[model samples]
Target: MSTAPKTSIIPREVDALKACTQGATYEGVIMPEDLPRLAAAVVSIQREMTGKVRFFRDESNYRMVTAELHTVVSVQCQRCLSALDYQLRAEMDLAIVVSEGQLESLPKEFEGWLLDESGSADLYEAIEEELLLALPIVSYHDQADCSASGQYSTGDFEEPLAEKKNPFAVLGDLKLAGKADSTDKESE
Candidate 1:
Protein backbone atom coordinates (compact mmCIF):
# COMPACT_ATOMS: atom_id res chain seq x y z
CA MET A 1 0.00 0.00 0.00
CA SER A 2 1.23 3.48 -0.77
CA THR A 3 1.76 5.79 2.17
CA ALA A 4 -1.48 7.67 2.87
CA PRO A 5 -1.39 11.38 2.10
CA LYS A 6 -1.42 13.64 5.16
CA THR A 7 -4.84 15.27 4.89
CA SER A 8 -8.32 14.91 6.31
CA ILE A 9 -9.69 15.26 2.77
CA ILE A 10 -9.40 12.43 0.25
CA PRO A 11 -6.68 12.97 -2.28
CA ARG A 12 -8.03 13.34 -5.82
CA GLU A 13 -5.06 11.70 -7.54
CA VAL A 14 -5.00 8.63 -5.28
CA ASP A 15 -6.70 5.35 -6.14
CA ALA A 16 -8.68 4.90 -2.93
CA LEU A 17 -9.23 1.20 -2.39
CA LYS A 18 -6.30 0.19 -4.60
CA ALA A 19 -3.93 2.30 -2.50
CA CYS A 20 -4.98 0.60 0.72
CA THR A 21 -3.30 -2.62 1.81
CA GLN A 22 -5.42 -5.72 2.29
CA GLY A 23 -7.37 -5.48 5.55
CA ALA A 24 -6.46 -1.81 5.81
CA THR A 25 -8.92 1.09 6.01
CA TYR A 26 -8.51 4.64 4.69
CA GLU A 27 -10.55 7.43 6.29
CA GLY A 28 -11.33 10.93 5.10
CA VAL A 29 -13.85 13.78 5.14
CA ILE A 30 -15.55 15.37 2.14
CA MET A 31 -16.89 18.91 2.21
CA PRO A 32 -20.14 19.13 0.28
CA GLU A 33 -19.31 22.59 -1.06
CA ASP A 34 -16.33 21.06 -2.82
CA LEU A 35 -18.61 18.70 -4.72
CA PRO A 36 -20.87 20.58 -7.10
CA ARG A 37 -22.74 17.42 -8.08
CA LEU A 38 -23.78 16.67 -4.52
CA ALA A 39 -24.28 20.29 -3.59
CA ALA A 40 -26.82 20.67 -6.39
CA ALA A 41 -29.06 18.12 -4.66
CA VAL A 42 -29.26 19.98 -1.36
CA VAL A 43 -30.24 23.38 -0.09
CA SER A 44 -27.18 23.48 2.16
CA ILE A 45 -24.86 21.02 3.81
CA GLN A 46 -24.75 21.00 7.59
CA ARG A 47 -21.75 18.75 8.07
CA GLU A 48 -18.84 17.34 6.13
CA MET A 49 -19.22 13.69 5.18
CA THR A 50 -16.91 11.42 7.14
CA GLY A 51 -16.20 8.11 5.48
CA LYS A 52 -13.88 5.11 5.40
CA VAL A 53 -12.98 2.78 2.58
CA ARG A 54 -11.80 -0.71 3.40
CA PHE A 55 -9.92 -2.87 0.92
CA PHE A 56 -9.77 -6.63 1.08
CA ARG A 57 -9.87 -9.84 -0.91
CA ASP A 58 -13.15 -11.68 -0.61
CA GLU A 59 -13.68 -15.44 -0.34
CA SER A 60 -13.49 -15.63 -4.13
CA ASN A 61 -10.13 -13.80 -3.95
CA TYR A 62 -11.65 -10.88 -5.80
CA ARG A 63 -10.30 -7.43 -4.93
CA MET A 64 -13.08 -5.68 -2.99
CA VAL A 65 -13.97 -2.31 -1.49
CA THR A 66 -16.47 -1.27 1.16
CA ALA A 67 -17.25 2.39 1.75
CA GLU A 68 -19.20 3.64 4.76
CA LEU A 69 -20.30 7.26 4.90
CA HIS A 70 -22.37 9.72 6.99
CA THR A 71 -23.33 13.36 6.57
CA VAL A 72 -26.16 15.89 6.98
CA VAL A 73 -27.83 18.29 4.56
CA SER A 74 -30.92 20.42 4.15
CA VAL A 75 -33.62 19.59 1.64
CA GLN A 76 -37.18 20.62 0.93
CA CYS A 77 -39.54 18.32 2.77
CA GLN A 78 -42.45 17.06 0.73
CA ARG A 79 -44.79 16.99 3.72
CA CYS A 80 -44.34 20.51 5.03
CA LEU A 81 -42.79 22.02 1.93
CA SER A 82 -40.04 23.56 4.01
CA ALA A 83 -36.32 23.16 4.41
CA LEU A 84 -35.54 20.29 6.72
CA ASP A 85 -32.27 18.85 7.91
CA TYR A 86 -31.70 15.30 6.74
CA GLN A 87 -29.06 12.83 7.80
CA LEU A 88 -27.46 10.91 5.00
CA ARG A 89 -25.71 7.59 5.46
CA ALA A 90 -24.57 5.05 2.93
CA GLU A 91 -22.63 1.78 2.71
CA MET A 92 -21.37 0.35 -0.55
CA ASP A 93 -19.64 -2.96 -1.31
CA LEU A 94 -17.93 -3.29 -4.65
CA ALA A 95 -15.61 -5.60 -6.52
CA ILE A 96 -12.86 -3.66 -8.23
CA VAL A 97 -12.66 -4.33 -11.96
CA VAL A 98 -10.37 -2.87 -14.60
CA SER A 99 -13.09 -3.06 -17.25
CA GLU A 100 -16.78 -3.98 -17.61
CA GLY A 101 -15.70 -7.14 -19.43
CA GLN A 102 -14.23 -8.37 -16.15
CA LEU A 103 -17.63 -8.07 -14.45
CA GLU A 104 -18.62 -11.50 -15.77
CA SER A 105 -15.82 -13.11 -13.76
CA LEU A 106 -16.82 -11.68 -10.39
CA PRO A 107 -19.37 -13.44 -8.19
CA LYS A 108 -22.94 -12.18 -8.40
CA GLU A 109 -22.70 -11.26 -4.72
CA PHE A 110 -20.59 -8.22 -5.47
CA GLU A 111 -21.36 -5.10 -7.48
CA GLY A 112 -18.76 -4.44 -10.15
CA TRP A 113 -16.71 -1.27 -9.72
CA LEU A 114 -15.32 -0.46 -13.13
CA LEU A 115 -12.33 1.81 -13.49
CA ASP A 116 -10.34 3.38 -16.29
CA GLU A 117 -7.58 1.41 -18.03
CA SER A 118 -5.25 2.88 -15.41
CA GLY A 119 -7.09 0.72 -12.86
CA SER A 120 -8.40 3.68 -10.86
CA ALA A 121 -11.80 5.05 -9.98
CA ASP A 122 -12.30 8.56 -8.67
CA LEU A 123 -12.70 8.24 -4.94
CA TYR A 124 -14.94 11.31 -4.68
CA GLU A 125 -17.27 10.27 -7.49
CA ALA A 126 -17.75 6.77 -6.07
CA ILE A 127 -18.58 8.16 -2.64
CA GLU A 128 -20.93 10.69 -4.23
CA GLU A 129 -22.85 7.89 -5.95
CA GLU A 130 -23.35 6.15 -2.63
CA LEU A 131 -24.55 9.37 -1.08
CA LEU A 132 -26.91 9.99 -3.97
CA LEU A 133 -28.46 6.57 -3.57
CA ALA A 134 -28.99 7.29 0.11
CA LEU A 135 -31.27 10.25 -0.64
CA PRO A 136 -34.98 9.59 -0.10
CA ILE A 137 -37.09 9.33 -3.26
CA VAL A 138 -39.91 11.14 -1.49
CA SER A 139 -38.80 12.92 1.64
CA TYR A 140 -41.43 13.78 4.20
CA HIS A 141 -41.52 15.19 7.70
CA ASP A 142 -43.03 13.29 10.60
CA GLN A 143 -46.81 13.61 10.85
CA ALA A 144 -46.46 15.89 13.86
CA ASP A 145 -44.11 18.15 11.98
CA CYS A 146 -46.19 18.33 8.84
CA SER A 147 -48.39 21.38 8.47
CA ALA A 148 -51.14 19.63 6.50
CA SER A 149 -51.15 16.30 8.26
CA GLY A 150 -54.47 16.60 10.17
CA GLN A 151 -56.32 18.89 7.82
CA TYR A 152 -57.53 16.37 5.22
CA SER A 153 -58.30 13.35 7.39
CA THR A 154 -60.22 12.81 10.58
CA GLY A 155 -59.01 10.14 13.02
CA ASP A 156 -61.42 8.00 10.95
CA PHE A 157 -60.60 7.09 7.38
CA GLU A 158 -62.36 8.41 4.23
CA GLU A 159 -66.00 7.34 3.96
CA PRO A 160 -66.97 4.77 1.34
CA LEU A 161 -67.77 6.42 -1.99
CA ALA A 162 -71.44 6.54 -3.12
CA GLU A 163 -72.41 3.98 -5.76
CA LYS A 164 -73.44 5.46 -9.10
CA LYS A 165 -74.95 3.97 -12.28
CA ASN A 166 -72.30 3.03 -14.86
CA PRO A 167 -72.30 5.05 -18.09
CA PHE A 168 -72.28 1.70 -20.01
CA ALA A 169 -75.42 0.37 -18.24
CA VAL A 170 -77.68 1.52 -21.13
CA LEU A 171 -75.51 -0.41 -23.61
CA GLY A 172 -76.03 -3.64 -21.63
CA ASP A 173 -79.83 -3.05 -21.59
CA LEU A 174 -79.79 -2.47 -25.38
CA LYS A 175 -77.85 -5.73 -25.90
CA LEU A 176 -80.39 -7.66 -23.80
CA ALA A 177 -83.24 -6.15 -25.87
CA GLY A 178 -81.47 -7.18 -29.12
CA LYS A 179 -81.05 -10.71 -27.76
CA ALA A 180 -84.78 -10.90 -26.92
CA ASP A 181 -85.63 -9.79 -30.53
CA SER A 182 -83.29 -12.49 -31.97
CA THR A 183 -84.94 -15.14 -29.69
CA ASP A 184 -88.46 -14.10 -30.92
CA LYS A 185 -87.32 -14.50 -34.58
CA GLU A 186 -85.88 -17.92 -33.82
CA SER A 187 -89.12 -18.96 -32.09
CA GLU A 188 -91.12 -17.82 -35.18
Candidate 2:
Protein backbone atom coordinates (compact mmCIF):
# COMPACT_ATOMS: atom_id res chain seq x y z
CA MET A 1 0.00 0.00 0.00
CA SER A 2 1.37 3.37 -1.03
CA THR A 3 0.59 6.48 1.01
CA ALA A 4 0.87 9.64 -1.04
CA PRO A 5 0.75 13.19 0.19
CA LYS A 6 -2.15 15.34 -0.94
CA THR A 7 -1.08 17.75 -3.68
CA SER A 8 -3.21 20.80 -2.99
CA ILE A 9 -2.74 24.46 -2.22
CA ILE A 10 -0.40 25.18 0.67
CA PRO A 11 -1.92 26.57 3.83
CA ARG A 12 0.31 29.60 4.37
CA GLU A 13 -2.21 31.95 5.90
CA VAL A 14 -3.57 30.67 9.17
CA ASP A 15 -6.88 32.51 9.35
CA ALA A 16 -7.55 33.58 5.77
CA LEU A 17 -8.78 31.82 2.68
CA LYS A 18 -6.21 30.84 0.07
CA ALA A 19 -6.36 29.85 -3.58
CA CYS A 20 -8.14 26.60 -4.38
CA THR A 21 -5.90 23.72 -5.36
CA GLN A 22 -6.41 20.12 -6.47
CA GLY A 23 -4.83 17.02 -4.94
CA ALA A 24 -3.19 14.15 -6.74
CA THR A 25 -5.43 11.57 -8.36
CA TYR A 26 -5.17 8.25 -6.52
CA GLU A 27 -5.75 5.08 -8.55
CA GLY A 28 -5.06 1.42 -7.70
CA VAL A 29 -6.26 -1.18 -5.26
CA ILE A 30 -5.77 -0.55 -1.57
CA MET A 31 -4.21 -3.64 -0.02
CA PRO A 32 -5.67 -5.52 2.92
CA GLU A 33 -3.00 -4.17 5.27
CA ASP A 34 -4.24 -0.64 4.61
CA LEU A 35 -7.86 -1.49 5.32
CA PRO A 36 -7.73 -1.76 9.12
CA ARG A 37 -7.69 1.90 10.16
CA LEU A 38 -10.05 2.89 7.35
CA ALA A 39 -12.37 -0.08 7.89
CA ALA A 40 -12.63 0.75 11.58
CA ALA A 41 -14.16 4.11 10.71
CA VAL A 42 -16.38 2.84 7.91
CA VAL A 43 -17.37 -0.49 9.49
CA SER A 44 -19.85 -2.13 7.11
CA ILE A 45 -19.90 0.88 4.83
CA GLN A 46 -16.52 -0.11 3.40
CA ARG A 47 -18.16 -2.04 0.62
CA GLU A 48 -19.48 1.19 -0.90
CA MET A 49 -16.07 2.74 -1.67
CA THR A 50 -13.47 1.38 -4.08
CA GLY A 51 -11.80 3.52 -6.72
CA LYS A 52 -9.93 6.78 -7.32
CA VAL A 53 -10.02 9.90 -5.16
CA ARG A 54 -9.64 13.27 -6.85
CA PHE A 55 -9.60 16.04 -4.27
CA PHE A 56 -9.47 19.79 -4.70
CA ARG A 57 -9.00 22.40 -2.00
CA ASP A 58 -10.48 25.85 -2.49
CA GLU A 59 -9.62 29.26 -1.06
CA SER A 60 -12.55 29.17 1.36
CA ASN A 61 -11.18 26.16 3.20
CA TYR A 62 -13.57 24.04 1.18
CA ARG A 63 -12.13 20.71 0.13
CA MET A 64 -13.93 19.00 -2.70
CA VAL A 65 -13.13 15.30 -2.74
CA THR A 66 -14.50 13.35 -5.66
CA ALA A 67 -14.24 9.61 -6.11
CA GLU A 68 -15.11 7.39 -9.02
CA LEU A 69 -15.88 4.41 -6.82
CA HIS A 70 -17.65 1.11 -7.54
CA THR A 71 -18.85 -1.15 -4.78
CA VAL A 72 -21.81 -3.32 -3.80
CA VAL A 73 -23.06 -2.08 -0.45
CA SER A 74 -24.87 -4.67 1.61
CA VAL A 75 -28.35 -3.62 2.58
CA GLN A 76 -31.36 -5.50 3.90
CA CYS A 77 -34.64 -4.93 2.12
CA GLN A 78 -37.25 -3.33 4.34
CA ARG A 79 -39.91 -5.67 2.99
CA CYS A 80 -37.69 -8.76 3.28
CA LEU A 81 -34.90 -9.91 5.57
CA SER A 82 -32.76 -10.99 2.62
CA ALA A 83 -29.52 -9.08 2.06
CA LEU A 84 -29.11 -7.09 -1.14
CA ASP A 85 -26.27 -5.40 -2.96
CA TYR A 86 -26.75 -1.76 -3.96
CA GLN A 87 -24.44 -0.07 -6.41
CA LEU A 88 -23.50 3.30 -4.98
CA ARG A 89 -22.24 6.46 -6.66
CA ALA A 90 -21.03 8.99 -4.14
CA GLU A 91 -19.57 12.53 -4.36
CA MET A 92 -18.96 15.06 -1.63
CA ASP A 93 -17.42 18.42 -0.66
CA LEU A 94 -15.94 19.06 2.78
CA ALA A 95 -15.06 22.40 4.35
CA ILE A 96 -11.73 21.86 6.10
CA VAL A 97 -10.71 24.55 8.55
CA VAL A 98 -7.05 24.66 9.58
CA SER A 99 -6.41 26.28 12.93
CA GLU A 100 -3.07 27.45 14.28
CA GLY A 101 -3.18 24.82 17.00
CA GLN A 102 -3.98 22.12 14.48
CA LEU A 103 -1.15 23.24 12.24
CA GLU A 104 1.31 23.29 15.13
CA SER A 105 0.43 19.70 15.96
CA LEU A 106 1.14 18.34 12.52
CA PRO A 107 4.60 17.41 11.18
CA LYS A 108 6.54 19.90 9.12
CA GLU A 109 6.18 17.81 5.97
CA PHE A 110 2.45 17.57 6.55
CA GLU A 111 2.03 21.26 7.35
CA GLY A 112 -0.92 22.46 5.26
CA TRP A 113 -4.60 23.24 5.54
CA LEU A 114 -5.69 19.80 4.38
CA LEU A 115 -2.97 17.96 6.27
CA ASP A 116 -2.75 19.95 9.49
CA GLU A 117 -5.02 18.48 12.14
CA SER A 118 -5.29 16.94 15.59
CA GLY A 119 -3.25 13.80 15.16
CA SER A 120 -2.89 12.18 11.75
CA ALA A 121 -5.96 12.20 9.55
CA ASP A 122 -6.13 9.19 7.34
CA LEU A 123 -6.89 9.91 3.70
CA TYR A 124 -9.13 6.86 3.53
CA GLU A 125 -11.11 8.12 6.51
CA ALA A 126 -11.81 11.43 4.81
CA ILE A 127 -12.74 9.70 1.58
CA GLU A 128 -14.95 7.16 3.32
CA GLU A 129 -16.72 9.71 5.47
CA GLU A 130 -17.49 11.88 2.47
CA LEU A 131 -18.87 8.97 0.50
CA LEU A 132 -20.87 7.59 3.40
CA LEU A 133 -22.44 10.96 4.08
CA ALA A 134 -23.51 11.23 0.45
CA LEU A 135 -25.06 7.75 0.47
CA PRO A 136 -28.77 7.24 1.09
CA ILE A 137 -29.73 5.91 4.50
CA VAL A 138 -31.43 3.03 2.81
CA SER A 139 -30.56 1.75 -0.64
CA TYR A 140 -31.47 -1.21 -2.86
CA HIS A 141 -30.32 -2.37 -6.23
CA ASP A 142 -32.84 -1.80 -8.99
CA GLN A 143 -34.18 -4.78 -10.88
CA ALA A 144 -32.37 -3.70 -14.05
CA ASP A 145 -29.06 -3.63 -12.21
CA CYS A 146 -29.61 -6.89 -10.36
CA SER A 147 -27.74 -10.11 -10.95
CA ALA A 148 -28.80 -12.43 -13.76
CA SER A 149 -30.58 -14.77 -11.31
CA GLY A 150 -33.43 -12.27 -10.81
CA GLN A 151 -32.36 -11.63 -7.26
CA TYR A 152 -32.65 -7.97 -6.25
CA SER A 153 -35.42 -5.52 -7.01
CA THR A 154 -36.11 -1.99 -5.81
CA GLY A 155 -39.85 -2.81 -5.78
CA ASP A 156 -39.28 -5.56 -3.24
CA PHE A 157 -39.12 -3.01 -0.47
CA GLU A 158 -41.59 -0.40 0.73
CA GLU A 159 -41.20 2.28 3.38
CA PRO A 160 -43.79 2.49 6.12
CA LEU A 161 -45.83 5.57 5.30
CA ALA A 162 -48.43 5.28 8.05
CA GLU A 163 -47.58 6.50 11.50
CA LYS A 164 -47.54 3.73 14.06
CA LYS A 165 -49.63 4.03 17.22
CA ASN A 166 -47.52 4.59 20.28
CA PRO A 167 -47.49 1.70 22.75
CA PHE A 168 -47.87 4.17 25.62
CA ALA A 169 -51.38 4.91 24.41
CA VAL A 170 -52.45 1.44 25.57
CA LEU A 171 -51.04 2.16 29.01
CA GLY A 172 -52.98 5.39 29.16
CA ASP A 173 -56.15 3.53 28.25
CA LEU A 174 -55.45 0.92 30.95
CA LYS A 175 -55.01 3.69 33.52
CA LEU A 176 -58.30 5.20 32.43
CA ALA A 177 -59.96 1.80 32.71
CA GLY A 178 -58.59 1.36 36.22
CA LYS A 179 -59.93 4.75 37.22
CA ALA A 180 -63.38 3.90 35.85
CA ASP A 181 -63.36 0.51 37.59
CA SER A 182 -62.40 2.15 40.91
CA THR A 183 -65.24 4.64 40.56
CA ASP A 184 -67.75 1.85 39.90
CA LYS A 185 -66.53 -0.16 42.88
CA GLU A 186 -66.81 2.85 45.15
CA SER A 187 -70.38 3.47 43.93
CA GLU A 188 -71.20 -0.18 44.76
Candidate 3:
Protein backbone atom coordinates (compact mmCIF):
# COMPACT_ATOMS: atom_id res chain seq x y z
CA MET A 1 0.00 0.00 0.00
CA SER A 2 1.09 3.56 -0.67
CA THR A 3 0.80 6.49 1.74
CA ALA A 4 0.40 10.18 1.00
CA PRO A 5 3.32 12.39 1.97
CA LYS A 6 2.73 14.93 4.74
CA THR A 7 3.98 18.01 3.00
CA SER A 8 3.42 21.65 4.00
CA ILE A 9 3.95 24.98 2.30
CA ILE A 10 5.45 27.88 4.29
CA PRO A 11 6.51 31.40 3.31
CA ARG A 12 10.27 30.96 3.48
CA GLU A 13 11.28 31.89 -0.01
CA VAL A 14 13.72 34.65 -0.97
CA ASP A 15 12.21 37.97 0.04
CA ALA A 16 9.29 36.06 1.55
CA LEU A 17 9.31 38.56 4.40
CA LYS A 18 10.91 41.50 2.64
CA ALA A 19 7.75 43.56 2.78
CA CYS A 20 4.41 43.23 4.51
CA THR A 21 1.16 45.06 4.04
CA GLN A 22 0.82 46.71 7.46
CA GLY A 23 -2.26 44.60 8.26
CA ALA A 24 -2.10 41.38 6.30
CA THR A 25 -2.70 37.98 7.87
CA TYR A 26 -1.61 34.49 6.83
CA GLU A 27 -3.53 31.59 8.31
CA GLY A 28 -3.29 27.84 7.84
CA VAL A 29 -2.84 24.41 9.41
CA ILE A 30 0.09 22.01 9.37
CA MET A 31 0.16 18.36 10.24
CA PRO A 32 2.08 17.79 13.45
CA GLU A 33 4.30 15.29 11.69
CA ASP A 34 5.44 18.03 9.32
CA LEU A 35 7.24 19.77 12.18
CA PRO A 36 10.17 17.54 13.06
CA ARG A 37 11.21 19.22 16.31
CA LEU A 38 7.69 19.31 17.69
CA ALA A 39 6.90 15.83 16.40
CA ALA A 40 9.95 14.48 18.22
CA ALA A 41 8.74 15.90 21.51
CA VAL A 42 5.51 13.90 21.51
CA VAL A 43 4.82 10.20 21.27
CA SER A 44 2.59 10.55 18.20
CA ILE A 45 1.50 13.27 15.86
CA GLN A 46 -2.18 12.64 15.21
CA ARG A 47 -3.63 16.15 14.95
CA GLU A 48 -3.28 19.23 12.80
CA MET A 49 -1.76 22.36 14.33
CA THR A 50 -3.81 25.42 13.45
CA GLY A 51 -2.42 28.94 13.43
CA LYS A 52 -2.41 32.45 11.95
CA VAL A 53 0.37 34.97 11.52
CA ARG A 54 -0.60 38.62 11.40
CA PHE A 55 1.68 41.39 10.17
CA PHE A 56 1.54 44.87 11.59
CA ARG A 57 3.74 47.95 11.55
CA ASP A 58 4.69 48.99 15.04
CA GLU A 59 4.73 52.61 16.10
CA SER A 60 8.40 52.77 15.14
CA ASN A 61 7.49 51.42 11.69
CA TYR A 62 9.38 48.19 12.38
CA ARG A 63 7.89 44.97 11.07
CA MET A 64 6.05 43.01 13.74
CA VAL A 65 4.55 39.54 13.54
CA THR A 66 1.99 37.98 15.82
CA ALA A 67 1.03 34.35 15.79
CA GLU A 68 -1.60 32.33 17.64
CA LEU A 69 -1.60 28.56 17.55
CA HIS A 70 -3.04 25.59 19.42
CA THR A 71 -3.17 21.84 19.03
CA VAL A 72 -3.92 18.58 20.80
CA VAL A 73 -1.16 15.99 20.83
CA SER A 74 -0.75 12.57 22.35
CA VAL A 75 2.00 12.17 24.92
CA GLN A 76 2.81 9.33 27.25
CA CYS A 77 1.36 10.14 30.64
CA GLN A 78 4.11 10.19 33.26
CA ARG A 79 1.75 8.94 35.94
CA CYS A 80 -0.47 6.49 34.06
CA LEU A 81 2.14 5.12 31.65
CA SER A 82 -0.54 5.49 28.95
CA ALA A 83 -1.16 7.82 26.07
CA LEU A 84 -2.75 11.12 27.04
CA ASP A 85 -4.16 13.95 24.99
CA TYR A 86 -2.21 17.08 25.87
CA GLN A 87 -3.28 20.50 24.71
CA LEU A 88 -0.64 22.94 23.50
CA ARG A 89 -1.12 26.64 22.82
CA ALA A 90 1.16 29.59 22.16
CA GLU A 91 1.07 33.28 21.21
CA MET A 92 4.03 35.11 19.71
CA ASP A 93 4.63 38.84 19.28
CA LEU A 94 7.97 39.21 17.56
CA ALA A 95 9.81 42.22 16.14
CA ILE A 96 11.75 41.29 13.06
CA VAL A 97 15.41 42.06 13.61
CA VAL A 98 18.00 42.43 10.89
CA SER A 99 21.00 43.05 13.14
CA GLU A 100 22.05 41.70 16.53
CA GLY A 101 21.80 45.23 17.96
CA GLN A 102 18.12 45.37 17.12
CA LEU A 103 17.42 42.61 19.60
CA GLU A 104 18.81 44.73 22.43
CA SER A 105 16.40 47.58 21.64
CA LEU A 106 13.18 45.60 21.05
CA PRO A 107 10.23 46.64 23.16
CA LYS A 108 9.37 44.56 26.22
CA GLU A 109 6.05 43.61 24.66
CA PHE A 110 7.68 42.11 21.58
CA GLU A 111 10.03 39.17 21.28
CA GLY A 112 13.05 39.36 19.03
CA TRP A 113 12.69 37.62 15.67
CA LEU A 114 16.26 37.05 14.58
CA LEU A 115 15.92 36.35 10.89
CA ASP A 116 18.63 34.36 9.16
CA GLU A 117 21.34 35.98 7.04
CA SER A 118 18.96 35.57 4.10
CA GLY A 119 16.39 37.78 5.88
CA SER A 120 13.61 35.17 5.88
CA ALA A 121 12.21 33.39 8.90
CA ASP A 122 11.11 29.76 8.47
CA LEU A 123 7.38 30.01 9.12
CA TYR A 124 7.02 26.37 10.11
CA GLU A 125 10.14 26.38 12.25
CA ALA A 126 9.02 29.38 14.25
CA ILE A 127 5.61 27.89 14.88
CA GLU A 128 7.16 24.60 15.81
CA GLU A 129 9.31 26.33 18.41
CA GLU A 130 6.23 27.94 19.91
CA LEU A 131 4.44 24.63 20.12
CA LEU A 132 7.41 22.95 21.76
CA LEU A 133 7.59 25.73 24.31
CA ALA A 134 3.91 25.27 25.16
CA LEU A 135 4.18 21.53 25.69
CA PRO A 136 3.97 20.42 29.31
CA ILE A 137 7.32 19.78 30.93
CA VAL A 138 5.89 16.48 32.14
CA SER A 139 2.60 15.34 30.65
CA TYR A 140 0.17 13.42 32.84
CA HIS A 141 -3.50 12.41 32.99
CA ASP A 142 -6.01 13.84 35.43
CA GLN A 143 -5.91 12.57 39.02
CA ALA A 144 -9.29 10.90 38.79
CA ASP A 145 -8.26 8.76 35.83
CA CYS A 146 -4.52 8.30 36.22
CA SER A 147 -3.52 4.62 36.60
CA ALA A 148 -0.94 5.38 39.28
CA SER A 149 -2.09 8.69 40.68
CA GLY A 150 -1.34 9.30 44.36
CA GLN A 151 0.65 6.09 44.50
CA TYR A 152 3.87 8.09 44.77
CA SER A 153 2.82 9.51 48.13
CA THR A 154 4.09 7.98 51.39
CA GLY A 155 0.63 6.82 52.47
CA ASP A 156 0.06 5.13 49.13
CA PHE A 157 1.50 1.81 47.98
CA GLU A 158 4.97 3.35 47.39
CA GLU A 159 7.62 3.08 50.07
CA PRO A 160 7.78 5.99 52.51
CA LEU A 161 10.86 8.16 52.75
CA ALA A 162 12.88 7.76 55.92
CA GLU A 163 12.85 10.62 58.44
CA LYS A 164 15.89 12.90 58.06
CA LYS A 165 17.69 14.85 60.79
CA ASN A 166 18.31 18.58 60.34
CA PRO A 167 22.07 18.92 59.63
CA PHE A 168 22.13 22.52 60.89
CA ALA A 169 20.59 21.54 64.26
CA VAL A 170 24.10 20.84 65.63
CA LEU A 171 25.09 24.42 64.86
CA GLY A 172 22.36 25.69 67.15
CA ASP A 173 23.58 23.41 69.94
CA LEU A 174 27.15 24.63 69.44
CA LYS A 175 26.00 28.24 69.79
CA LEU A 176 24.25 27.37 73.11
CA ALA A 177 27.40 25.67 74.41
CA GLY A 178 29.57 28.69 73.51
CA LYS A 179 27.11 31.03 75.26
CA ALA A 180 27.01 28.82 78.36
CA ASP A 181 30.83 28.65 78.51
CA SER A 182 31.13 32.43 78.16
CA THR A 183 28.52 33.01 80.89
CA ASP A 184 30.34 30.68 83.32
CA LYS A 185 33.76 32.21 82.53
CA GLU A 186 32.35 35.72 83.00
CA SER A 187 30.62 34.80 86.27
CA GLU A 188 33.73 33.11 87.72
Name every residue pair that clashes in candidate 3: none
* Residue-wise C-alpha lDDT for candidate 2, range 100-163, written one tens digit per residue: 6654654443424354543234555555555456556655445454343364453667687899
- lDDT against the true structure, each candidate: 0.79, 0.50, 0.76
RMSD of model 2, in Å?
12.8
Give me the overall lDDT of model 2: 0.50
User: What lDDT is obtained when candidate 1 is compared to the true structure?
Assistant: 0.79
Model 1 clash pairs are: none
Scored by Cα lDDT, where does model 3 land? 0.76
- Give the top-scoring candidate (TM-score): 1
Model 1's TM-score against the true structure? 0.72
Per-residue C-alpha lDDT of model 3 across residues 36-137, encoded as one tens digit per residue: 888788887767887787777778888878889878888999877899987778997778787888888877877887886677667777778888888888
Clash pairs (backbone) in predicted model 2: none
Number of clashing residue pairs, candidate 1:
0
The best-first sequence of candidates by lDDT reads 1, 3, 2
Q: Is candidate 1 or candidate 2 better by TM-score?
A: 1
Q: What is the TM-score ranking, best to worst? A: 1, 3, 2
TM-score of 2: 0.42
